[model samples]
Target chain A: MKILVCISKTPDTTAKISFTDNDTKFNESGVQFIINPYDEWYALVRAIELKEKDPSTIIHLVHVGPAENDAIIRKALALGGDEAFRINSHPGDDYYVAGQIVNLAKEQHYDLIFTGKETIDYNGSSVGGMIAEFLELPYISLATKFELNGNTATITREIEGGEEVDEAALPIVVSCQKGMAEQRIPNMRGIMSARTKPLKAIEPVAIDPLTSISSFELPAPKQGVKMIPADNPEELVRLLHEEAKVF
Target chain B: MSVLVFLDQAEGHVKKSSFEAASFAAKIAEQTGTEANGIVLGEVKDDLQSLGKYGIKKIYHAADAQLNQFDDEIYTALIADTVKSSGSNVVVLSNNFNGKAIAPRLSVRLKSGLISGAVGLPDTSNGFKVKKSVFSGKAFANVEIKTDIKIITLNANAFKVTEGSGTATIENITTQIPRRKVNVREVNVVKGEVPLAEAELVVSGGRGLKGPENWGIVTDLAKALGAATACSRPVSDSGWRPHHEHVGQTGLTIAPNMYFAIGISGAIQHLAGVNRSKTIVVINKDPEAPFFKAADYGIVGDAFEVVPKITEAVKKLKGQK
Candidate 1:
C-alpha cells in the first residue's frame, strides 16, 4: 500500500510571533521553523507506524511550499518517510493549497492520505475536507485513534460531547490529531539513512487564490492584573461579579 | 439571493454557538437587503419558530433520524442540495466541530468560496471582504471572497447574539440519505458535563496540580463558576486526564468569555487554543511565569490554598445571588 502524508512547515511553538511591512506580512527574521507538530507527531508518525507493521507499505511525505521548506521536509524524511516530494509553490490560501495537493495526489492515486487536522499557523481545518471533496472520497477529520485490518479501517473521533467510532474501506483520507500516535525522534541511523533517500521537486499547477489577505493586525495587549490579598479571596469573587461581570 | 444559516444541534437542542451564527447571518442579510433562513439537519426538539428572535424569517428542518448523529458526507450533500433549492447565495455556520467537518466539503460541492474562522462581518462596500484570526490568534487577516457563492464559518463567541421581535415560519424539507461509506458503530456520549465548545467560561489545570487525585481543585472552581474543565497537553499526555479534555494547539481550540488557567506555565501551544478568550486569569506560584504577561488577571500563590479559597468565595457569591 502506498500512503501519502502531507506536511507543513511552521514556526516553532516557542518562537515569538512578529509581523513586518506595517503588519502586512509575517516576520521571518530570527525565527526558527519546524515541522508542524500535528503533521510530525500524529499524521506522519501514524503513517510510519502503519508502514512498520506491513513491509509492503511505502510512506511518502508531501509538502507544498518554496525551497525553504525542504529542510523541514528532510527532517520528516529522517523520522521514517521512505521518500519525499515538494510541490514547488507558494503557500497561499487553503483552497489554492488544497487544489495543488489534490492535483498531485490524483495522479499518484495513493490508497490512503493523511494530514494534520489543522496547521498550527493558519488554524484553518479546511484543507483535508476540500481535498476529499475535490477527489470525491471519504474524509474523516480530527480522528484520535485509527486501526487497520486488511483493507478496512476503524477510526474514532471526538464530537461535540461524545466519541464516535466509524469504519471505512481503503482509499480514504484522515486528518489526525493527538492520541493517534506518539512523537518520534530521529536516531543516528535514521538520520544517516535519510541522507540517501530521494527528494523530488514537482512544479505546481497554476491556480488563482479565491481569498486575498488585505492586512494583519496583532491582538490587543493585555491589561495589568488586579492584585487582591491572598488572605482576601472573597474580594476576588466580588471583583469578578461587580467589576468583570463574568460569573 | 438570501442568507442561509446552518444551525447545529445535539440531542435535539440548539447549540449556543449556532445562535451566534444565526445572528451573524441575519446581520449580513440585513446589510445586503435580503432575508435570512436557517436549515437544521437533525431530529431537534427545540422550538424552531422561536429562532426568529435572531432575525430568521424561516427555518427548514431535515428531520431525518439518521442525522441525529453527524456524518459529514451526508450533511454536505444534503446541505448543498438545500442551498441550491433555497437560492441562498450566502451560507453561514459556526466554526464548531460539526461546521468544521462539513463546511469545506460543502464549499467544494457547491464550488463556492469559503472563509473559516471568520471574526467580523463582511465589508461589502467594495465587494465582499471578511476578517478572520490568523497565525493562531496572534494576528488577524482581512480576506476578500470573489466567488458568487460564499460559505462562511464564524468563530465561536466572536459575535454577539441579539434578539428581535419577530416569529419564524418552520418548513420541513426531505432529502435522500447518501450511501454510507462510513458506518458509525457506537457513540459514547459524555452526559451531565458542560461541553467545552460553547462554554462561556473555562477553568483549566496543568501538571502543576501534581496528580489526578488532586483534580478536585480544578473541578471545584469550574463548578462554582459554572464553567467547563480543561487541561494542558502535558496533563493529558501523562494520562492524568482524558484526551477530550486536552486544550491546546494539538487538542481543542476554544474562545470563551473567561479563561481561568491555573498551574499552567503558558506555553505558546496552550495559549494558541485559548488566547482568543475575551478575558484570561492566570494563577501560579512562579511570578516569572510567561502567562502573566498575557493574562488580564494574575495571582501568584499555591494552588492547594488559593483554589479552595476562590471556590468558597464563588460559592458565597452565588448564595447571595
Candidate 2:
C-alpha cells in the first residue's frame, strides 16, 4: 500500500504568534518551526503504524513549501516515512496546496492519503477535503480510528454531537484528529536511517490562486481579570449577571 | 442577482449555526441589491417558509430521503448544481463540519474563491475582502477573494441570527442526487445533556479537579448552567475525561459565548482552541494562574470549594433550588 502523508511546518505552539514585515507575513524571527503537531502526532503516527504492520506498505511524507522546510521534512522522514517529497514552491493558498498534493497523489496512485484535520498555521481544514475532491475520491475528515481490510477502509469520524462510522473504498483521503494516535518522537536508529532516506524535491506545476491575504493583525489583548472573592459566591453571581451579563 | 445560503440540518431540525449563516447571507443580499435564497438538501421537519424570518425570500428543498444523511461528495455536487441553476454569484454556509467539508469542494468545482471562518461581512467598498481568524484565534487576517463566484463560510457563533417579518416562498428543486459510494454503518453518540461545540456556555475542568471521581463538581456546574462539559488535555490523557471532551489546540475548537474554566492553568494550546469565547471565567487556587490573564472573571479558590458554590448559586438563580 502506498500512503501519502501531507505535513506542514508551523511555529511551535508555545511561541507567541506574531507577524513581521509590518504584519503582512508571519514573523519567523526567533521562532522554532516544527512539523505541525497535529500532522506529526496523529497523521504521521498513524501512517507509521500502518508501515509497521506491513513492511511492504510505503509511507511517503509530502510537503508544500520552499527549501527552508526541508529540515522538518527530514525530521518527518526520521519519524517513520520511508521517503519524502518537498514541492519547491510556497503554497499560496489552500487550493494551491491541495493541487500540489493531488498532482503527487495522481502520479503515485497512492491507495490512501493522510493529513491532519487542519494545519496550525492556516487552520483552514480545507486542504485534505479539497485534495480528495480534486482527485475525485472519498474523504473522511476528523477521523479518530481507521481500519483497512481488503479494498475497503472503515473510518470513525468525530461529528458535532456524535461519532459517524463510514466505509470507503481504496484511494481515499482521511484527515486525522488528535485521538487518532499518541505523539511519537523519532528514535536514535530511526534518526540515523532518515539520513539515508530518499528525499526528492520537485518544482511545483503551474497553479492559480483564487485568494490573497490582504492584511494580518494580532488579536486584541484580553482585558484584565476581574477577581471575585473566593468565599463570596454571591459576588460571582452578581458579576455574571451585572458585569459580564453572561447568565 | 440572487444569494444562496446552505441550510445545514440534522435529524429534521436546522442547526443553530445555519440560522446565523442564513441571516448573514440575507444581509449580504440586501447589500448587493438582490434577494436571498436558501437551499436545504434533506428531509426537513421544520416549516421551510418560516425560515423567511431570516430575510430569505425563497427556500429550495432537495428532499431526497437519501439526502437526509450527510454525504460530502453528493452534497457538494448538489450545491454546485444549485448555484449554477440559481445563478448565484455569492454562496454562504455555516462553518461547521458539514460546511467545512463541502465548501472547498464546491469552490473547486465552481472555480470560485472561498473564505472559511468568516467573522464579519465583506468590506465591499473597495474589493471583496473578508475577515477571518488566523493563528488559531491569535490573530486576524483579511483575505481578498478575486473570483467571479464568491463563497463565505461563517463561523458557528460569529454572526448573530436576525429575524425579519415575512415568509419565504418554498420551491422544490429537481436534481440528480449523486450516488455516495460510502456507507454509514452506525452513529455512536456521546450521551450528554449539552452539545459541546454549539453550547452557549461551557464548564471545563482540568488536572486540578484531582481525578475522574471528582468530576461531579464540573458536571454539576455544567448541568446547573445548561452548559456543555469539557476538560483539559491532561485530564483526557489521564482518562478522567473522554478524549472528545478535550478542548485544546489538538482537540476540538469551540467558540461558545461563555466558558467556565475550573482548576485549569490556561495552557496556550488549550487557550488557542477556546480564546474566542465572548466571556471567560476562571476558578483556580493559584491566583497567578495564566488562565486568569485571559479570563474576563476569576475566582481565586480551590475547585472543591468554588465549583459547588457556583453551581448552587446558578441553581438558585434559575429557580431550580
lDDT of each: 0.88, 0.89
**TM-scores for all predictions:** 0.97, 0.98
lDDT of 2 by residue, B89-148 (tens): 999998787888898888889988889889899888988999997777777899999898
DockQ of each: 0.73, 0.79
lDDT of 1 by residue, B280-308 (tens): 88889888888888887777889889989
Share of real interface contacts recovered by each model? 0.72, 0.76
> Stretches of candidate 1 above 4 Å error?
none
Best-fitting candidate, scored by TM-score: 2
Alpha carbon lDDT at B279, candidate 2 = 93
Candidate 2 residue-wise lDDT, A174-200, digit = tens? 999877888987999989999999989
